[model samples]
Target: MKRILLLAILAGGVVTNGMAQSKGNLNSLGKNDPKAKAILDGVSKKFSQLKSVVANFVLKIEGANNSVTDAKKGTVYLKGAKYKVNLDGQEIISDNKTSWTYAKDANEVTINNVDPNSSTLSPAKLFTNFYDKDYLYRLDGEITEKGKVLQNIEMTPTDKSKNVFKVIVSIDKKNQNISKMKVFEKNGNHYTYEITSFTPNTNVSDATFSFDPKKYPGVEVVDLR
Candidate 1:
């Protein structure tokens, strides 16, 4: 669970050579495809115009042999620098200044201070700002699912020291929103996030981004900061 949470925070947060070759030559060429960038720019623009967003997604993890290892559903609420994520047995809430990582099973919550200006990527940033730098991307064409057209883009990180090597982003062409992201790690593990539902320009209250200790009596609070 810690590993998955870390993956969620890292630069948006790879595949084997054979698997790489199977995908295509986009990453091998190491050039940014203008068409892909344009689409990503459109997505960023659309997201920037919204006041807030609530997105529900599914996190699917796969093993080296392409078998499903584990799957969990999660939801994220975003308002400017503030965001909250609800995942299996855990909730990560941040009000742009402080963050709370709560474990439901342990009835514990860890607190830490956070810099809103930091370049770290939240699940919300993963949709827009993730492609802004250090990546070589190309349009991998399109596919139709559920009667919607989704454009596929293959992205490769220029930095070799990163744990994640590649990320395949699928964009909802018509809506100009991200629909799915398949991330491959050097460990041969695969993590895929599929947006189940997206509601933009939500009227969520600021209080939603904070964890109220009063709501849970006898909960342990660990202040790391």
Candidate 2:
């Protein structure tokens, strides 16, 4: 009789384990439900309409070892398909046709044309569209920051040559604006951008996106093209 009782207890244990495993799977499925997808789609649609914007930003860059560096106050001007970032007393300009990085301290500038197919420092890709063909996306969940709820979504690139390993975007639900972005590279490097303010459809002058090297006489221009 003791042998039979021992066998019954072993069988009961196996059944209990199976039920627990099944419940865990169900919970995982719930996290990927349609609610998250709806939130992502709504935010993407809102960003598609942005044509021009001018805003003040405070950029914070963190390294792989969690070392942090902060940039001083800067002004960002964006028009149609061009952008200019004035930071650290230097100006980085992309005129939709050509791009230039002007360094005031070193008195040097690097110039290159915009490569629509390549993913680099092109402001066009950073603000408007993404290379969705080489990446897959999933909505992570909702998070609250600064008393506002945001939809957090994760993106993983399929093409290894893309260099980008993962990307996370936190989009504000109420304003349909992106609050934060984190990019992780395959080399273990990462970049994060936190948006402090956003003003859409602001009228920016065309000269803001133009580059005139003659204005900076001592700066050397390096052409990367």
Candidate 3:
């Protein structure tokens, strides 16, 4: 199965007057702005230069009526293709090879192997040339908040059959790091992921990405990999 946890919470988009209603699928990517590509390229370059990342974020889900339905706070640790996320008593760890999903309530950890060529979009893959394909994007100008400038970019998927119809991404003007991402669904639901804090080149060990059942006295291990 696809990585359910990250896919459910994550994901990404803009100043378009109105979001286009997604219906049938499109085989090819649509319009891609050169300006957006340049800015995105810079974002990718900066992220590639980082040794590691420690970020705290919040996910807010809003209903069709624009009411806040649920919210969650989480932290993500990133080092190359390896990363770990702790959210709502659930831990997802991937060592660039194997993946460990631990549920605190169940006291069980499920294991799976990573597919290197798979275009699975985890938070770790969000920055590394992620916008170049299967997406049509454009620069939506900038926004200023608390004396900080954020560049806004709007994105729509080439495949219209997907549940997510659009995405709006905000990047810090100074650091070029991601500030926030808002994802819109076809069913009048949306998710917002705001990067509360970010630290690059943080010290993290390889062992941090690999969850060990032994560490937990009575945790059960389900090796599906």
Per-residue lDDT value at 119 in model 3? 60
RMSD values, in order shown: 5.9, 17.1, 5.5
Question: Backbone clash tally for model 3?
Answer: 3
> Backbone clashes in each candidate structure, one number apiece?
2, 0, 3
Model 3 TM? 0.85
lDDT at 122, model 3: 64
Give per-residue CA lDDT, model 3, range 1-225, as digits (tens): 224434433344111211111122234554466676667666666776778888889888899988999988988888887888888888999887888888889999999888766766665454444434456777899999767899888887767797878888887889887788888889998788888989999999999998877898899999997
For candidate 2, lDDT tens digit of each residue in 1-225? 211111111111111122212212212223323454465555545544667777665555566785665444566776766778776667777787888877788898888887877644345554333443434455687888899997776755556676667777677878866676676767676656666777888878888887887898877879898
* Candidate 3 Cα errors over 4 Å, as ranges: 1-31, 124-131
Model 1 lDDT-worst window of ten: 12-21
Rank order by TM-score, top first? 3, 1, 2
Each model's C-alpha lDDT?
A: 0.71, 0.59, 0.72
Q: Tell me model 3's lDDT, rounded to 2 decimals.
A: 0.72
